[model samples]
Target: MDLAQFKEDVIQYSKQIGIDKIGFASPDVFTEMKERLRTQQELGYQSGFEKGSIEERTEPKLHVPESKSIISIALAYPSKLKDAPRSTREERRGLFCRASWGEDYHDVLNERLYRLASYLKERYPDLQFRSMVDTGELPDRAVAERAGIGFTGKNTNLITSEFGSYVYLGEMITNIPFAPDEPVEDSCGDCNICVDACPTGALIQGGQLNAQKCIAFLTQTKDFLPDEYRGVIGNRLYGCDTCQTVCPKNKKKDFHNHPEMEPDPEKVKPKLKPLLSISNREFKETYGKMSGSWRGKKPIQRNAILALAHFKDVTAVDELVRLMKEDPRPVIRGTAAWALGKIGDWQGKEAIESAQMKETDEQVLDEMRKGLEFFTENV
Candidate 1:
C-alpha cells in the first residue's frame, strides 16, 4: 500500500464527508499535558467532569497498544444565529451557548468518525482504529493541537486559522503511521481579550483555566450557583461563550457548513418563564436533542430563575414564588428563593416569608432567610 497516497486519499475523503479540517499526529505520550493536568488537579481547579486518570488520559499507547498516529478533525459551527428571537420585556428569554445550538455535537462528530473508520477499513482491511469525541478519556483539544489542526488559545480552546475557536473537534487513534502535520503558527500575541472578558476570572494568567469558577462549568452543575456568579451568569441557560465571542480571531468566522448544526432560535433561546414549569416529557421532547440538556432540566431551570432575576422580570414573580414554595428539589427551591430576593419585589418577599413558615430543609430555610434579608437591608 502506498502510505503517502493513502494519506492524501483520506484527507480528500474527509472533506467529501463534511469534515471541515483534518490533520495527522504521531501518538507519542502527551508529556506536557500530563504535567498541566497534575497542576490543575493540585489546585483543585478541575470540573470533576473529567473521565479518566491523568496517565490514561495522556497515554495513547495504553488506550490502543498499536497506536502509531492520531487523526484529528474539526467541524466549524455558526457563531451568529439567523433571525434570532427577541427577548421582550414582558417575556425575557434564556440562551444556550453557540456550542449547544443544534443537535448534540457528540452525535454529529461521532457519526463522521465512524464513516472515516469504515472508509479506512475498506482500504487497509485489518487496520486498528478507535474513535473518540469530547466525552472520551483522551483530551480532544490536546490531540487537535498535536495533530496541527489548530493552536491552543488563551480561552483554552483550539483556534484554527479558517474556523477560529468555533469548531467541534474529534479524533481517531490508528495503527497506521501517517506522517504528522506541522502545528499551526498562531498565538494570542499579548491579546488578553478572552481572559479579561471572563466574568468570573476563571482564566488564570497565561492559558490555564479554573474550571470550578468558569460560568460554562457552573451552568452545568446540579447544585446552587455561588452568590458571586449569580449576577454574572445573566441569561445564559447552558454554557458561557463570552471568552470566545470576545476573541479577535473569531471575527467574521461564522460557518453554516452542516445542516445538522443549525440553531432553532425558539428552542435555544426559549422564554425563561416557560422553562421553570416545563414538564419532564415536554423538556425532553424539546431540548433533549441538544447537548445542553444532558444535565437534564434541573440546571437549566435553575439558570432560568437566575436569568429572570437578572432581568428583574416582574412578570415572572408569580412563577418564581410557586417554584420556591412547591418545587420538590431543594436546589430549585433554594435558587428560586435567592432569585426572589435578588429581584426584590414586595410579593416575592412575602412569598419567601410564607415558604419560610413551611420549609423544613435547612438549606431551603437558610435561602428563605437570605431572601427576606434583602427587604430588611433596603429598609
Candidate 2:
C-alpha cells in the first residue's frame, strides 16, 4: 500500500477497534525527553519510582532500537459516580475513576495493539515492531503530543480534544515509515487552576511533578508514610485526583456515559471499618485485577487508618486503639496511634495510655505519646 493510503487506513481501523485517538510521531521527539529524564533523576524527583522506570525513561531506544515511526493511541477511562465518599468513610456507594472501573486495560489495549501489529506484519513480512501500554520505557505521553494526539497538561497527564485528559496511552514502534503527525500546541494558556487545586504540591510548577510530593505515589507506596505528607493526604486512599477534577478540559467529557470505562461498584469509596477488617486473601481476590492492587493490601489498610485519623472520628478511636495494640504491622500501629489522638475522647486517651505503657517499638511508643499529647494539649 502507498504511504498516504496506509496511514489513512490504519488510523481509521484504530478508531474502529475502540481506540479513541491516534497520532504518528517521529523518533526524534525522544531527544528532549531524554534530557528531562536525566535532570529528574539527578534532582531525585524519581528516588522512589521503581528502578526500572528510571532506566527505561532515560532510554526509549531500548524498546525499539531502530524505531523510525511511533503510533500513539489513547483509550478513555471513567470519572463519574453515583456517589462520592468522604475520605475516611467507606460506603457501598461511591465514585471511582473510570479507567480502573472495568476489566484490566493492559490486556484490552495490548491485545488491540498486537492485532494492529500483526495485520501490518502480514502485509510487510520483513517489518519490525514493538508495542507497549503503560509498562515500557518509551514516554507514551510525549509521543502522543508530538503525533498531534493532544497536549500535555500541567498535571503531567496527556490531554486529547475528544477524550480530554481522561485517557490511557499506548504505543506501537515500527520500522516502516508512516507520515508523522503535527505536534499539538499547549492549550493550558495561564490556567493554573490544576496546580493551585493540588492538595499536595505535586504539581511543583506548571507541567513538572515532584513524584515524592504526589499523593498518588504516597497512597500506592509499600514503605512507611512520610510524616510531611500525612495532612495533605486528606481522604485519598489511593491516587489523588483533585487536579484532574479541576481541569477545564476534563469538565467537557461525559464520564458517566462512557461505556468502555466503568467504575467497580465495590471500590468507589470503600469504608474504613471494613477496610480494616479486609483479609489478605479477600484483598487479593477483590482487588487482584485493579491498578491499585499492585502494592498489596498493606498500603491500602495503612491509608485507611490515616484517613480515619484525618477525619478524627471518635467512633473509630476504639478500633484504632485496638489496632495500635494488636495489629501486626508497625506502620499500621503508628497510624492507629495517631488516629486515636486525633479522636481525643476518653476512650481515645485511655487507649493511648494503654498502648504507650505496653508498646515495645520505640517508634510506635513515640507516635503514641505524640498522639496522646496532640489530644490532651491541643484540647
Candidate 3:
C-alpha cells in the first residue's frame, strides 16, 4: 500500500464526512508549548481544569506509545446566529458563546474521528490510533498548529485562514507516519485588540491567559463569582467571546457547513428569567445537548442571576428574590442576593432586607447586606 496515496484518501474521506479541515503532524514533543505551559504554571495562570501535568500535555508520545504521527481536525461553526432572539427590556436573555451555540462539539468531532478510524481500520487492520477531543491530555491547539491546521493567534486561539478562530479542534495520535503540512505563518502584528478587549484583563500579555481572571472560565465555575467580575461578564451565561469577536481575522468568517453546527437562536440566547426557575429535567431537556451544559445548571443559573443584574432588569426582581430566599444551594442564594443589590429595584431591596432576617448562612447574609447597601450608596 502506498502511504502517500493512503494519506490523500484519508483527507478526501475526512472532507466527505464534513470535517472542515484536516492535517497531519509528527508526534514529537511540543518544546515551545512546554515552555509556555511551564511559564503559565509558575505565574499561576493555569485554569485548574487542565487534564494532565505539563509533561503529559506537551508530549504527544505519552498518550500514544509508538506514535508516529497525529491527525488534527477542525470543524468551523456558525459565527453569527441566524434570526437571533432579541433581549427586550421586559424579557432579557443570557448568551452562551458561539462555541456552545450548537450541539456539543465534542460529540460531533468524536463521531468524525470514529468514522475516520473505522475507515482506516478497514483498509489497514493494524492501524493503531487514540482519539482525543478538547478534554484529552494532548493539547489540541499545539497539535493543530504543528499539523498546519492554523496558526496560534495572540488570544491563544487556533486561527485558520479559512475559518478564522470559530472552529472546534480535535486530534488522533496514530502509529502511521504521515507527511506533515506547512504551518500558517501569519501574526497578529500590531493588533492589540483581543488582548486589550478582554473583560477581566485575563490576556495579561498577548498569548498568555490568566484563566482565573477570565470571564469564560469564571462562568463555568460552580462557586460564587468574584465581585469585581460580576459586571464584567455582562449577559454571558457560559463562556466569553469578547476576544474572538474583536479579532480582525474573524471578520465575515461565518461557516454553516454542517447542519448540526447551526444554533437555535432561542436556545442559545434563552430568556434569563426562565433559566432561573428551570427544573433539573427542563434544563436537561432544553440545553443538555449543548456543550455549555457540561458544568451543569449551577454555574449557568448563577450567571443568569448576574445577567439579570447586568441588565438591571427590574422585571426579574421577583425571580431573583425567590432564588435568594428559597434556592437550596448557598452559592445560588448568595449570588441572587448580590444580583438583587446590583439591580437596585425597590422591591428587590425590600426582599433582601426581609430575607436577611431569616438567612442563617453568613455568606448569603453578607450578600443581602451588599444588596441593601446598593440602595444606601445611591441615596
Ranking the candidates on lDDT from highest down gives: 1, 3, 2
Among all windows of ten consecutive residues in candidate 2, which has the lowest summed lDDT?
88-97
Tens digits of lDDT, candidate 3, 215-235 = 889999998788899978889
Candidate 2: tens digits of C-alpha lDDT, residues 254-322 = 554345456566575677777777898998787777676777888888888877777766667667777
**Candidate 1 lDDT by residue in tens digits, 138-222:** 9999999999999999999999999999999999999998999998865889898889889999999758999999999999999
What lDDT score goes with residue 2 in model 3? 94
Lowest summed lDDT across 10 adjacent residues in model 1 is found at 183-192
Estimate TM-scores for all models. Answer: 0.99, 0.91, 0.98
lDDT of each: 0.94, 0.76, 0.91
Clashes of 2: 4
Instruction: Name the regions of candidate 2 deviating beyond 4 angstroms.
Output: 50-59, 83-99, 256-260
Highest TM-score among the candidates is held by which one? 1
